[model samples]
Target: MKAFKTSKRVLSSLIAIMLLVMSCQSFLAADGDEKKPLNIPEITLENLQVRGGSTTYLVDNPPYSETAPTMRDFDFGPGSDNMQDAYIVYNYGNEVMIESLTLVGWWPKDQAVKNISLEYFKDGQWVTAQENIEVPWQTSGGTEEEVEITLTEPVTTMKFRVKINSAYHSWSDKICMHLMRPNGYIVTEFKPLTDAIAQAEKLVSQVLIGNKDGEFSQDAVDSLNAVTNEIKEKLDAGLVTADDIPVMIEQIETAIEEFTSSQNPMENAPAAEAENLTVSLGNTAYLTDRQISTGMTVSFTDSENPAYLTLDFSGKNLNATGLTLLASSSDKFTLNMSAEAEIDGVWTEIAAGTDFNYRCDVQGTEGHKITFDSCTASKFRIKINSSTAESFTVYEILWDGLYDTDTSAMDNLINKANSIIKNPASSDYPDLLDILKIVLSPAENQETSILANQGKIDTITQLLSEAISAFDGLAQYEKGDVNHSGSLEIEDVTLIQKHIVKLLQETDFFDEYLADVDNDGVISIKDATSIQIAISSK
Candidate 1:
């Protein structure tokens, strides 16, 4: 039966060759014109025409249709029934020389095309260029097997045909011829560079000049600007090609790195402190530094008497987001811990943990972190609950959040006061030195004080200005000494009152400027009252 089938295939090929010769001769006679072969760099679907096939299977399924296949359409065929006689002819519409043909087979080892014969039409006759070419089965799942056949001598033809002699399977007659191409395929698609370039330009525009956060140095900014401009010019002039896109993108990336690396980091602000921090067991407060410092530990071995730590920012608030506890146990034990924040006089639990058997290994201390949504509160507490531990040491505790206060005003005031103290106008006034010394200390403290608000800073500034004014007044006339008696006394108070009731004229008073004791631009009962108060206090 196999010998009979082989004889039948040989006879079928002979008959097909005769028919192809007749068709070619008829096509040549119809044209009766000789023309030069087209200079096509590569064959593509647009230029190639495909026709002729046996009955197709699954032609209506997706990625397959009744429509004829093109040069690179991979899901072209699975010739049904008479697989040995199935043939496909590809026409290039014009004569072109092809050096190699690549055939991609169907997936799944059994359904792939196995053997094929290649024939080309030249000199008005069908010529067998290659015979019995074997295509390997696609054994690698989901990946197509491509077989390339390099011709012993390159062939020039307007059309070629591939005869599907056999497939690996014969039961279902399922055979597929996936793709065929002269030479290899070329992809010409690329993503547009406009969006990427625009994004880089936007970053450059947002850069600022300063040593603060999000600011860059002028040199870095300038360098980035130059690079961006050059790239933009090249893009605008259409000098950039699809092949150049990756290199251009890399250049922009390098420029961004350089710009970021050139930034001057912001100066680190001093660490903030709570207004009052205490660690206590019940009513008794621990006398430690109440902070996370080196060699500091608040340990309690008795599980019956646990301790809790509290941080009070007075009336000020912190936007608390997270906290860390650096703790270790002397033995294997479970240390349960929890935290709460005071909101509107109510203590609400924020985070909790248990089964922490953290021990001091060779790596030193280990920290457990608890993170939660940010909460605005003035007081926070960490409770070390009852645990089965011989002893546990808390080396440190750190809070992560922003202190909910803007101290820029107080900071500026301190700077101004420091300038005045460093560059004194005159050293003769010991009283002025004393007053300034009193003003400078509190002003400096407010710069980092969590309790410092704008209202308090404004009041302090007003008071300091008044003190300097009174010091200046001493050089001219004794403030509040309206009687010129060389002292502030009851007579000075009486003269201010008599002058207010028109008994003594303003011209009769000694230094009427001194009579306005409060420097409120008026000599009235208020000045008399101020003098009396000063005398009584003295």
Candidate 2:
């Protein structure tokens, strides 16, 4: 069986445009606040046109009738009766959650599709959105009949497929299918502006691989590199923002058009091959001096059970969408949590505390995810405060960020990213020979490069994406929150003394959770002594 080809010039163009738009937009999106439906462009996947089963005649038929059954432009053949499987995917430029899909076919009741499965891409793989989708065999029907398959949850992806099991031999027109992204207010803000550039730079490296391997012409490389540099110019001036993400994605659609266009078609670009990114935090990361984690060096502010943790990304800046923390308390309690980052050498508040109501049944000993101010920061600090409690325990902190944990992989990626910043998108960089090396090398061989010794790769597409996120793979109670309030004041000392003298209920919030200040997981006078120690030493 033969595979369909992708346009050669479009991909590099897509990479360049996405970055240019990202370089020109805002930093924050209020979740789902924008009221108007965004003008997200539809992505075209050149890789998905292929053969899966035998005896299935693949036919590219024109529109069966006028109004696209479900509004899809084209349809494929139902093929001969035995033709069991055929798959196709459409790339919507931006990542979108599709809740429903519509399919239209003009076939005899016998030839109509009987069963189907719908899948969407998430993380790094495809997940079944609707399995065994039953399609009532349509009697000879007009081309206007539409079949809608509803999904359980909104599946986010740029590519999705419908695999038809069996169909009566189609005599004439094929089926046209339409996929929809919920037309709701979609906030374009995702990652920090600079991170978007990094992602764009990552895509640039991929195109360079195609270029070195003769998959892309020099003209394509020159054109893309020029756009990449313009993006860098914007970043250098700190002129970019997060609101550009949608436009950045739209730019990718533009590139795809040029990529798939006959102008300079690459020989073997895979259909639906690009793996979306979900960059994670790495292992070498650590908290302040590893101090509080050890339970040895305990410090307190003027408040009781003060819950706070500080982290330094060092070379890896934290540009997270949201953060999650693990808080420890023997009993349930509420605390106001806040996050701050050091930007421009001064501390700035990013996420204001919107205290979570801690219901013992639902939240358990763990606190929930928190939304904070989003920005790239060298150092980030999280503080949790309580009005009624004095001491609590914080178990862990997690930051969601970009791919490449092994600093070396990031270093290689950074090298490529820097070239984008250093050069123009239209100029050619002869030094990008490293792109082919990064693409073709086995991931386990680090002697050559850091990314070479990591996650999944070998194929050009996987290599590009796995290269970024290949390194796969936090707490808390605000401790000393003794009175069940998040502060370390003399009032906590009074509560602890009272608890020990049989004046207080053992199950009360303060006595149960914060009184165990030493964090032995048990209540004891020693905890009171330790809280005093943390106080006097202050």
State TM-scores per candidate. 0.26, 0.27
Could you tell me how far off, in angstroms, the CA of residue 6 lies in candidate 1 after the best superposition?
93
Candidate 1, TM-score vs. the true structure? 0.26
RMSD of candidate 2 to true structure, Å? 31.2
**Cα lDDT of model 2 overall?**
0.45
**For this target, which candidate reaches the highest lDDT against the unseen true structure?**
1
lDDT scores for all predictions? 0.54, 0.45
Q: Which prediction has the highest TM-score against the true structure? A: 2
Can you write out model 1's per-residue Cα lDDT over 121-187, one digit (the tens) per residue?
Answer: 6655678877777655436344444456676666766556666666665444445444454531112
TM-score of 2: 0.27
What is the alpha-carbon lDDT of model 1 when measured against the actual structure?
A: 0.54
> Which ranges in model 1 have alpha carbons more than 4 Å from their true place?
1-307, 313-316, 332-334, 354-357, 385-388, 402-538
Give a tens-digit lDDT track for model 2, residues 311-403: 665544546656665544445667677777778888778888768655543454464677764588766666655423334444345565532
